[model samples]
Target: MWRDPGAPADSFYEIRPECTDVPKSRFRIKAGKTLSARKWHAAFSPEGYLDIGKTLSRIHRGGIHPSIRGEVWEFLLGCYDPKSTFEERDEIRQRRRTQYAEWKEECRQLFPLVGSGRFITAPVVTEDGQPIQDPLVLLENNPDGGAIVPPQTPQDNNGMGPPSTDAANKLEKMTDKGVIQWMLTLHQIGLDVIRTDRTLVFYEKKENLSKLWDILAVYARIDTDVGYCQGMSDLCSPMIILLNDEADAFWCFERLMRRLRGNFRCTDSSVGVEAQLSNLASITQVIDPKLHQHLEHLGGGDYLFAFRMLMVLFRREFSFCDSLYLWEMMWALEYDPDMFWLYEDAEETSDKSEEAKARLKSIRHYGKYERENMKNASKSSEEPPLPISVFLVASVLKEKSATLLQQARGLDDVVKILNDVNGNLDAKKACVAALKLHKKYLKKAKKP
Candidate 1:
């Protein structure tokens, strides 16, 4: 039940790399050069052959310029690989658009309302692949232009003379029970969509709202298991606002969902927020046993309160713009320069330098070890190049530990305290704190 406070405030948070001694106010991109679209394109070019690690490091040290936020975000979100040529990415983009359109068409076929009144009757096919006639077309061709009368219901048999045209009209308005039950999520999705980013003028338009609904509805149909969740609208609103093309925005959101799908799974057998909450608790117990004991005493040892923050990656905790900044920085730090080439075929061993060969051998060994020990590992996936959102939750709790221990006597106090931090968090400080705690946890975990 987290609530977003309209638009983000004008304040900016300055984040610096873990080792940087530069003052927060003075933080800028690497070497003080701005990361414009031209510079980004050059760095990602095949001819330039710039190291992606170096480029991302520059972006991490100095944020991308405002003019190129949209373009740069696609790279960070894994929509395109650094090694892919512009032409290659364009082809991929077109393919993705086609795929998204097919999903939308599927939605329209299953739920006729999604057609936005563009089509009166949805096309259907019989089991043998025969096309069904359009009912609306038949109505349009009728000379009388009269309503299609429906058969009398049992209630109409009450010795009340032959049913009137009004009764037939009401009866003819059929309810697609199957479709209604299948799409029961429409109501919840609509509610959340309207509430999402309410402060933005873009969301006020009916067409924009419908576009959001269409994307969510189609996605729900595509991934029936996960379907539509409450917080998904919050995650998607930013993408809709930033990306112009609906297809492109849907693809970007899809990629993001791949990384975050674990958070939304609510089934008993699924490793979802409960698993992450356990990790957060373990981290807390080790780092600050006193606070952990206090929380335990207050019946919050489960750490359920951190659910919303981790579920949406702090979208409700920070302002909209700050959330974007935090996500970009997190993605940059998590970017693995070798990820692209890891699964691809390598050249002949003789052609590689000894140093290069050794690096490749090490990477292969690490991958093998990771795959073998993944079950026992605390992280659900391979260890990220940087810490994930769980650490940020730990950081926030640690930052407010003093206040909680001093004044919080029960669970309600803790909830109130966290609610107050909704839109007032400093992203840079939270990140720095999280990084420090991450190092500490790593050192502790390595102890025999």
Candidate 2:
């Protein structure tokens, strides 16, 4: 009734030359160096307080080194507060790992295959807790995780036979909505997992692939509000690879999702990235009216062509390594020091004195570009401004303005032009140009 976790995976990911050729990211390093490990350690007090303000500043100008990216990301993503001491963080880490193990056990109770070091590409059960007997869906363990092929064990007739006594009892016992939703999403997760970053050597190990599936599955179990979406694997994959510890990677992905969940929330009338696209249209109209008018004339005013870039954070447009580099650069530049407390939703800040509280709100933590926006941004707090990512999309648009305006006679041409930048876009220069374009757009937008 279940695939053996120790069974031969029958799947493998081969490294391609394109995957290894990482582009150099020297982010106009005239101001300061990339946040090296030494600087990272020095920022921490002897008692274990982290100087996040200084840390964010250096990271903004220059990105963090890969050796320490996952650890640094925990702070930036608000997994752990910079104010927490070494012992406190250690305790928190242990508690989180314990919590994650409990979650996996809970899921395993319902579906014994969850932590089995293998994932399903097809549904195993229905909403009513009955087994799905569709033999055609019994897919093979394809090397690339591609869709629909011959079964691995054709002699077994591609049938996932009736649930065994233990499995039947487990499914019949769980009648809760959360468990039901979790069961429904498992097959979808399997399908996406196979397609997610299959070209990387990191995914060659079947256990590594199962590790990612486990993280996503557990995440789905906890974050019931936004239970597993298609593009999430792309976001979660980097965390698993970056943070070797599965629990740490899960928490990191959770924290990262806190900032990005809005992009995944969709409604009847609009997709999640709609707000960013609206902002992009406004930005283009203000900063480059000529190009905006041309786009509108071409019926490309909605700016949906750039949706994939904003949706996956340009994971598709840039090389894998460059994508990570670009994420740190963008996150560093857009950092807000008060973000930690805001993200934590902590009430303890009220207990601190004015001086102590002021440190948390320090503008020094903001990047040069972010500091400018904070100074000149509208005072109305009702409507928060668009994220820096929208501005980054605008920057990409402006970079390709000439080609788009001239050659983009139709929407397809625009898509082709942007897609052509795949693996060629410079991560550093993209950050530099985004900040510059953001400043220019703000000035132009303020005009009467």
Candidate 3:
């Protein structure tokens, strides 16, 4: 994991047409600039803006519009063209499916040893103390024990008992944990495309949902102690799509799950969440201290709403294809900058102030939030580290801080503002902001 500490981190590259193959949909090219200019500057015209607006609107309406659906899906899947022959498509699908399946089995075996039942309900050490496991596989099996179990409580026989209120509260919290697990499992099963019905039910056609459930069940069996939870399905959705190969997806999800599994471990287990909230708070304070203070006053300091975004690495915000393109760009950047680091150096003596520690930490945190940590010791173990979403989020809030503080009255207002963002977001703008923040942090940390 520490092979390439000095790799130039590219998690903050600007998004342009060259990064993805999204066809000209609603966004239009401006009059003054050539396509080359637009690519170089990451610029798009007002017509382009309107198109993004339309795409987002369609998204909010519960589906990508038919006109742009193919482009959006293709882009999300990173499929530049639908020109593949039936045999080719089948081959690709089979490869992905096999990858997901094998990884799912691996994770199932490991989860039991790490989770071990009541330990999940109450734990001492995090699974991280052990070697990191495959996320795609872990994701296939539910992290929480399968099937819902109500909270357990010890009773006092001497005409006294733990307060019913306390018991109910604990049960509710436990239920939430179960819900999140379920969500991750659903996501792992590739049920992320929100349906036109507005229902969160899984698709049962051709035993698709069952396959997802089966995959999740394997994870559950590994850690039957931590069983299924709801929101977890949401976290697993992008993995299923990206891996397309079940074993690969299962392994990738398992890797992701190792870092993120703590998020829903138990009520007492909130260190991961708190760390993320702190990062968010730090960004707001560093970029716009005044707005940060105002939000803090409004109790926005808790930053609860941002939790989902952090957990899934912006999957909820961008289209799946867009998210993958953005991720691959970051990966490419990390790889390009540090291709040799894995083999050459075992350690670095650089001062923390000059090192990539914080930037690296930032990416880890964002990926943790996104639940997209890929820790496979590939042939090139020196992969560059990049966390593009942090840059994106920081840029967005920086761009809107003044307006948000001016118009909104409190923390609730801030949450509402963020939620309304829908899909009117500018990926390129966010990418630019991320780059700026990366530079800012690097400069601030430079040794005096």
TM-score for each predicted model, relative to the true structure: 0.70, 0.85, 0.47
Better of 1 and 3 by lDDT: 1
321-426 per-residue lDDT for model 2 (tens digits) = 6677788878777777666667654464466455654666667767666687677766424477567778878888888889988899898898899888887788
In model 3, the worst 10-residue window by lDDT is 155-164
Q: CA lDDT of each candidate?
A: 0.62, 0.74, 0.41
Rank by lDDT (best first): 2, 1, 3
Q: Which sections of candidate 2 miss by over 4 Å?
A: 1-32, 127-129, 133-137, 140-146, 149-170, 173-177, 345-356, 378-380
TM-score-better candidate, 1 vs 2 = 2
TM-score: model 1 vs. ground truth? 0.70
Candidate 2 residue pairs in backbone clash? none
* lDDT by residue for model 1 (148-204), tens: 211222421111111223322232222554344335565456546655665555654
Q: Lowest lDDT 10-mer window, candidate 2? A: 5-14
TM-score of 2: 0.85
Quote the positional error of residue 9 for candidate 1 in Å. Answer: 9.6
Best by TM-score: 2
